[model samples]
Target: MTVTPRTALTIAGSDSGGGAGVQADLRTFFANGVHGLVALTAVTVQNSLGVQGFSEIPVDVVTAQIKAVAEDMGVDAAKTGMLATAEIIQSVAKTLDEVHIGRTTDTPFVVDPVAASMTGHALLREEALEAIRTELFPRATLITPNLDEVRLLTGVSVTDAASQRTAAEALLEFGSQWVLVKGGHLCDTADCVDLLTDGSAIIELSGPRIDTENTHGGGDTMASAITSSLAKGADVPTAVAEAKRFIERCVMEAYPLGAGVGPVSPFWRLANPR
Candidate 1:
């Protein structure tokens, strides 16, 4: 059989820590057998400990990168994370709109609304939230938001599976085709649970929560892993299911790498497969 490798792209930031953002997405893509590509939107001086400083890529430069990638290398599926400003969000949203208008019809646009850090520090500008929800989110094939980002977008503080359901519906009305509400941030339980909804059906994925603090890039990892599956022709529900399994395995084998919280191992499948 003559076949080309599946390709996926990520429009996000650079993590100097080599754990989250661009680094994490590319790593997850490669591990999942998808060729990875990127259009960086920002640079962050960060370590496993925290982000010390950050700089947004100019809107023109960000626009150029996305155009360059899509024009040539092309994308079968794509995801976005950590757009630091409103301008960057608008640019990414518009570019993807154009990409879908032509050859990439079934390509899934996975948006990971990374509004805040695990420690409650804001990673995105407050002004950018409106751009993400209004400009980019409605165009998304699947929107993955952790509980914190869900509250920021929906104003519904999700504390359990029941509240998670409410938050998903509120997000749906905003126009995304599907919503995957990651419940990793919920403090009420020892088991990690995530909810995926597409108006009519609600799918719940649960696993015994591995006790670990090295989970900094969990949201980005989850979204990109799903994008990788979509690039390889998995349906939305199947992609979500496989990505959930991937993230859980990554967490299971995750080791502490730096002085502070480490990141989940996106390439954990090499050592252990489920």
Candidate 2:
């Protein structure tokens, strides 16, 4: 008899550039030894430089994909990214709720509050931001937000470690079981510091910042890594730490592959011949 690999699901938008969104999530899942499934919320015309246009998939189509995957292949863990509209967010939240009701033990949801691309193109509309805060955040197991997304969600500016902690705490009140406030956009030091808090304690993860322009989908990739780790039975804190370390290594060895901010090689761990 053969043992089948665990499966993970990504409910996100599509990146025509094949660098972020569902593409990045699936890459991370495969790299971490999970079969990847997808429920596309939108289609984006994007390149390494920027996103040019986007069209959201209808609610029915989104719902159909979720039901199809949840009913058959079954997911051990899941992550969401760039649900372009209020309707999409609400739809996904409901679908995840149904999945949770069915398989309470194996369902972990990682929510990446992706608002804009690295090139400054808006991915989620400003109005949809409120929908995520109101409808989706409460259902997520963990929410991963970068500096800009933290500001957008909590109306707080994170300029230092102290501010990051405060932001993480405030974000916890939004309804996620835990919050990871990414400090990559801060210019104060040569290290990237991220704060993971679950209301009581804060876990600070720091690593040497890779001085490279190839960070287009770092946020998406990190969140997916955490989801993959959790699907493989790691605790939340351990998963976050491991994912952070993996991302740091990827960044350190990042190669420029596009004219704009490029993608971190998600399969870097596999390429090591040692």
The prediction achieving the highest TM-score against the true structure is 2
Q: Each candidate: what lDDT? A: 0.86, 0.86
Report the C-alpha lDDT of model 2 over 108-171, residue by residue, as the tens digit. Answer: 8888999998788899987999998888778778899999999989999999988888899888
| 137-211 per-residue lDDT for model 1 (tens digits) | 788889999887888898999987889999999999988889999988886698889999999999998988888
Which residue ranges in model 2 land beyond 4 Å of their true spot? 101-106
Instruction: Give me the displacement of residue 91 in model 2, in angstroms.
Output: 1.1
